[model samples]
Target: MADIDFGDAPAWVAVVLAGGAFVISLLARRDSKKSAGAAVEAVTEARRASDAGVRSAVAAEESLALQRQEAAARQATEAEAARPRASLALHWQGGQIFHLVNEGTAPAENLQLLTVSDDAEPLEPFTRLGVGEVAEFLIMTSLASGAPTALEFAWDGQEDPVRLRVPRSG
Candidate 1:
């Protein structure tokens, strides 16, 4: 190689170049730190969004459960309203006089009283018994047997007979 001298200008140029390189390195390092911080912020934001999504799903499930429970309760109430009910009670007014009272919401049609013993006479059937109405009948039971312990009765729209216990006479 042939030695060539550039009269002290080469030394100054080398020093300037080295300073530029140092400044460039510092800027690069600053930009790298900013990028790392941005990456960490993005990860944190993603985690928060995931937690929110899980909470929303749980809330939706709870709302659906409440709706189902309300629907079931409404169906149960409707079924109870559709069922037929009979409320007939026997009341003893005096010695042989007894009254059958209709205390239900619906009317009792073709009301018939059944006799459990052979000695008792069958009472006349009622065509229709309205709500809050009463039907009087005479029960000719022997003094030894008193009144029938229980009286079985049937009415229209009822599939089974309802047995009512008779209160003993004083």
Candidate 2:
């Protein structure tokens, strides 16, 4: 057997050291549990904040898409409101005259005129006519002496060729 020597430490000193070490171990275990619980709470809070941010981003994207749709609709309406329309008529008190007029928001383009009478000469074509404009043509034949004559006009709306008819008006 090996001989153990305790020069100055007594038996009571050993007991006191063991008891203090046990108390310190218990306190350290309790503090570790509390720290672990706090860490779990922090993780849960971070998850919640991330979820809220994602929801807010989605809502903002949807709102921007709706605004784009509204702007497109407004542009379409404005385009529809800015198209030209043409009408032709015959007028006379002591002379016969053909009147071509534009009655729309925009100018008429490439306007060609035609009269139903077989003896009338071919009329000239107008390149461009503004809104509320009047183009007058002299008619050699009297419109009041015969059956109603039909007037036809063809023009461009920048999309498709448009045509309109007017009954004889004297």
Candidate 3:
């Protein structure tokens, strides 16, 4: 074997080297834990930002949907409140009350009924009735609020009248 020179290193050199190695290992472990913590925090922050964006987008869509519904409801109310002139009548019999008939060559379809001034209303619901089908409406004595209860039944291009009393129980 070739001779190995110690280069003035003493027997204690092994202990010094072991001590240095232990100190270096502790420092490396601490640095690694810090780096891992930083990585986790970064991921958490990114997730929170993504969630916030999604929530904002959902809120905007909901607001728009509500606005659309409100506009549609307002438009329907205006149309129903202002129709052309037509009226119907109220007839009573037994405990069962029904409507008078409104028929013509060009009568309307499922009538859009409304309260007339006190002397007119349609009194039937006709299916696909062309030019002479009858329309019916009900007027119970108990359901009348206006002094003179009147009804107006209107359809595609036709209108009629009937006077109905207010219903009481039903």
Question: What clash count goes with each model?
Answer: 0, 0, 36
Error of 2 at 22 (Å): 2.3
Error of 1 at 110 (Å): 5.1
Q: After superposition, how far is residue 119 of candidate 1 from its true place, in Å?
A: 10
Candidate 3 all-Cα RMSD: 12.7
Ranking by TM-score: 1, 2, 3
Q: How accurate locally, in lDDT, is each candidate?
A: 0.85, 0.66, 0.57
What are the per-residue Cα lDDT tens digits for candidate 3 across 43-62? 99999999998998999999
For residue 128, model 1's alpha carbon misses the true position, in angstroms, by 3.3
lDDT ranking of the models: 1, 2, 3
Model 2 lDDT tens row, 22-48: 999999999999999999999999999
Q: Give the best candidate by TM-score.
A: 1
Q: Ten residues in a row with the worst lDDT in model 3?
A: 85-94
114 Cα displacement, candidate 3 (Å): 16
Write down the TM-score of every candidate. 0.57, 0.52, 0.36
Scored by lDDT, the top model is 1
